[model samples]
Target: MTSLLEGLEFEHCDAAAARSIRDTVEDIYRRSYVQAIASGDPFDSPSEFMRRFDSYTDPRNRGFAYVIARVDGKPAGQIWGWSLPENARWWTGLNLDIGDDLEEFTAEDGTRTFGLSEIMVCTEYAGRGVARALHDELLGSRTELRATLLVEADNERAYQRYRAWGWHRIGWLRPGWPDAPKFDVLIRDLDLAVNEK
Candidate 1:
């Protein structure tokens, strides 16, 4: 879906568009790292995380999908995700926005849910509806019926933004990432008939 905010288009990554997707994801992570430090805290990058993270486009990496949001005809944001079957612990690993264990929260109606895993908007586009646009497309297009994203507990700006979109806290941060403060996991239930429609 195209956002009404000027020339913005949301597109999923295909094998042919993998390079563009990789570039956007890499930049997204880099900016996120910088943002953490600028705020007077340090955030750890997973060891060799880039190598493993870039495999999303590999055919062998089944069960995962990636998407990028382009604004003014440039890649401005990206979001990616995977499935979560039952009997898994926490569904989403403690990684930023990673969720393979979505069964932890199930609705009475039985539809499954997952995380936004990774939603990053280019720093230049910050405060625009770009993150929402990118994430809305991610959840709106998912085969699973529900989803959300993780936000650091100290990011007042982002905390407010996620709240405005109607997500609520469902979990807390687990230690391991370098200098990452305790985080609050925010979630949105897409199965709500009013919201889903």
Candidate 2:
């Protein structure tokens, strides 16, 4: 199995791959999201998802970076990020509650950049740890000081997995679209010294 994946390759995605991403995202969202947490069935009505995906992946968004994950020559997952506007106008800041102080993590500042991003692995790749692998690859690549993600609190399984990776919840709200209450905030500080290879 390892050998089958040994030859796999990954590359940066382009505008042309938007359709593939849409399809993959739909598949992952379907199998991963539970009705209890999801606003309804957005996958069934793919319009909004497509619109959001297009805008998010638009190349005009400067400093954007997204990578495709391949396994045994098959596209399996993806990891991507972009610059955040100042003061988190684009949410380019890391919201880490280090128990005592509140600090912002940015890409330009030596202080440490934070990625408010996403990583999705198909169920077939679940046990293989592809999601975590993809995450570590991107997070480690640029030496970000911290990272944050929004997830559904009810999805205990995902929450536990994130916790194991040293992530902690910050708070809650109606994020983005579909009008849902995903776990308001979760953060992880990038220990540059420890993560550096």
Report the number of the highest-lDDT candidate.
Answer: 1
lDDT of 1 at 88: 26
Count clashing residue pairs per candidate. Answer: 5, 4
lDDT of 1: 0.60
- Name the runs in model 2 displaced over 4 angstroms: 1-8, 14-40, 43-45, 89-112, 192-197
Query: What number of backbone clashes does candidate 1 have, counting pairs of residues 3 or more apart or in separate chains?
Result: 5
lDDT of each: 0.60, 0.59
Task: Quote the lDDT for 109 in model 1.
Answer: 30
Q: Worst 10-residue stretch by lDDT in candidate 1?
A: 102-111
Tens digits of per-residue lDDT, candidate 1, 1-197, equal 23435678877764346545565567666665555535543344533335546544556434455777777777777777655434423333444345544343432232365645567777777767787776667667666666656677877887887787778877775534444356787777775413633
* Candidate 2, run of 10 with poorest lDDT: 103-112
How would you encode candidate 2's per-residue C-alpha lDDT over 1-197 as one tens digit per residue? 46535554666654446445677765554443334326555532456655666777776655456776777666677777655544453332334444534442322442345544667766666657676666666666555566667777777877887887777777544454564344457777777324542
**Segments in model 1 whose C-alpha atoms lie over 4 Å from true places:** 1-4, 14-20, 31-33, 37-52, 55-61, 89-111, 175-181, 192-197
